[model samples]
Target: MSDEIAVPPRQDNQQWLRWIQAQYGGPACIRRGKRLHDALAQLEQSLARFRQPGHDDDWLAMVRIRLGQLHALAGDWSKLEPLLDADSLRIVQQLYTDLQPQLRLPPAPDPRPDVLRTALQELQEAIAFFNRRWLRHLQSLDLSFYERLIADYNRYYLLEKECLLQSPRLARLGFQPLPSLTWQSLLGRFPLLPMPRLRNETSEH
Candidate 1:
């Protein structure tokens, strides 16, 4: 029998999600550890073929995040722990510490400008630090990990900027106003935005 597996020419987020469900979902008794490993290897190959600089990183990030969730489901922390480098891990830990409260909130129809500004500043600082430390080694590291980091920062920046521009206090600050965004538009723009979902929560979903 051929060992080769056929994959789609262009893999999208939904495809990735489906692949994950097929591998990890269903009755617990039927789940196989080897299947999870094989699926992750296939995912890496797909990522190598499909990744496009500046565009596909977010997709890659979601795939990797899903892989981590699968590993946890398989009780294979050893596989997931090494997916990110030391610096990336540190940065992620810091981000969780700083952004956990805001991330846990339910969707807000009207968010405070001061709160948004604070979140924006934190993201800006995190992005600057990430770029300074990891920019040079980007290709060597898991692109998806970096993608997740960048996506999180950028999502907050966009969300906060939108809120701040609507503030009366900042009206005369002379910053050019971005076009107004609907809540759906804002959420759609950053589909990989970090959420409060735990690892088990993702696996179950």
Candidate 2:
């Protein structure tokens, strides 16, 4: 993806794009961890651009707010620091306050009106990030974090589901719940036992 975000003047979309690109691998190499890292990096660039000179205040505010959310989704704690830092706390606090309403909306309708397939892939990547990592964090957090994380996940998941439901192109896809209980059963049976790897059958002979 291009690093140019096409934001208003003094908006270093290029810089933001560069930072974001730094987090992910080339198109062929993009994986879950790399995607998460790239998302956070993009978000941070959005945050940094807000403080740069000549940027539109309203646009910057919106971008940073969304960036916070993207950061939250990607588990980018480092990006949160600016918001929590004593000097920037007020800005951070207001960002969250403003973000609450925006979060309620469905995600930007898959940008590709012509190609629903690409949009489906985008949604899958977005959801897979939560299923693999963020959801686990949500399930394990202390009361406070759990509440916040689950709410975020719920909103995101519902939005994705809504899009899928509306898309006639995606009618063939079926929902498959992940196996969460299997790991626990294995742990219960083995306690401290190390998992064994399968050996090659031919090697045994």
Candidate 3:
């Protein structure tokens, strides 16, 4: 069924896969707590493909997400700022959305359970990897939105884990700690907020 997708005349399919893998490796390197430039270069190649028209949406989505990860890795606020556009932000939102149990544990008797698990794990690992790199960038941006984003992500992950824990069919799926960050820690590292607090201090008195 996938023979065609498996082999494209332009070789775009395979090359896209290779690029995604390279981007993935780049982020893994950052998570390993090593220098980030080499990985950044690999990610740049992945993103370069996006400049060409006619790229697949799924592939473009990956490139956008990978660029976000790369920006976070470099701690280049100026560059990272542009990469965190609505499309890239949506990718971040979907990372937690995909983890939803009803979505993952779909009624049994379905074939390819292993494939589903693999897909879920790959995304989870990507989010985890991104989170670690993102926290470093967040530390510098001092954005309240960053705090809210991380907290919401952590909450959703915990909720999803609990859902998995109660699934009799999937209970054997084991577990992993929820991703998180603290306000105190956030404050300690990045004392200034990226946004200014707005108050409706109107003269009513």
Q: What is the C-alpha RMSD of each candidate to the true structure, in Å?
A: 25.3, 28.5, 27.0
**Span of ten consecutive residues with least summed lDDT in model 2:** 192-201
Query: Which candidate has the top score in TM-score?
Result: 3
- How do the residues 1-88 of candidate 3 rate in per-residue lDDT, one tens digit apiece? 5444333235464575465456465323123223323443444455345333345622234323433333233333233223344544
| Candidate 1 residue-wise lDDT at 160 | 44
User: Which of the two, 1 or 2, has more TM-score?
Assistant: 1
User: Which ranking of candidates, highest TM-score first?
Assistant: 3, 1, 2
lDDT (0-100) at residue 62 of candidate 3?
Answer: 35
lDDT of 3 at 67: 31
Poorly placed runs, candidate 1 (over 4 Å): 1-107, 139-205
Better of 1 and 3 by TM-score: 3
User: Across residues 1-205, which tens digit of lDDT does each residue of candidate 1 receive?
Assistant: 9788756456675675466457557322123323444544664565444223235542233333332233223242232233334443444444444333222223332234344334333443434443333333333444453344334443454344345345545533543422432333323432222322222222221
lDDT of 1 at 85: 41
Q: How many clashes (backbone N, Cα, C below 3 Å) per candidate?
A: 0, 0, 0
TM-score of every candidate relative to the true structure: 0.19, 0.17, 0.21
Cα error, residue 60 of model 2, in Å, equals 50
- lDDT per residue for candidate 2 within 89-176, as digits (tens), equals 3443443454342444434433232333332233334334423442353345334432343344434543454443455346325533
Residue 148 of model 1 has an lDDT of: 45
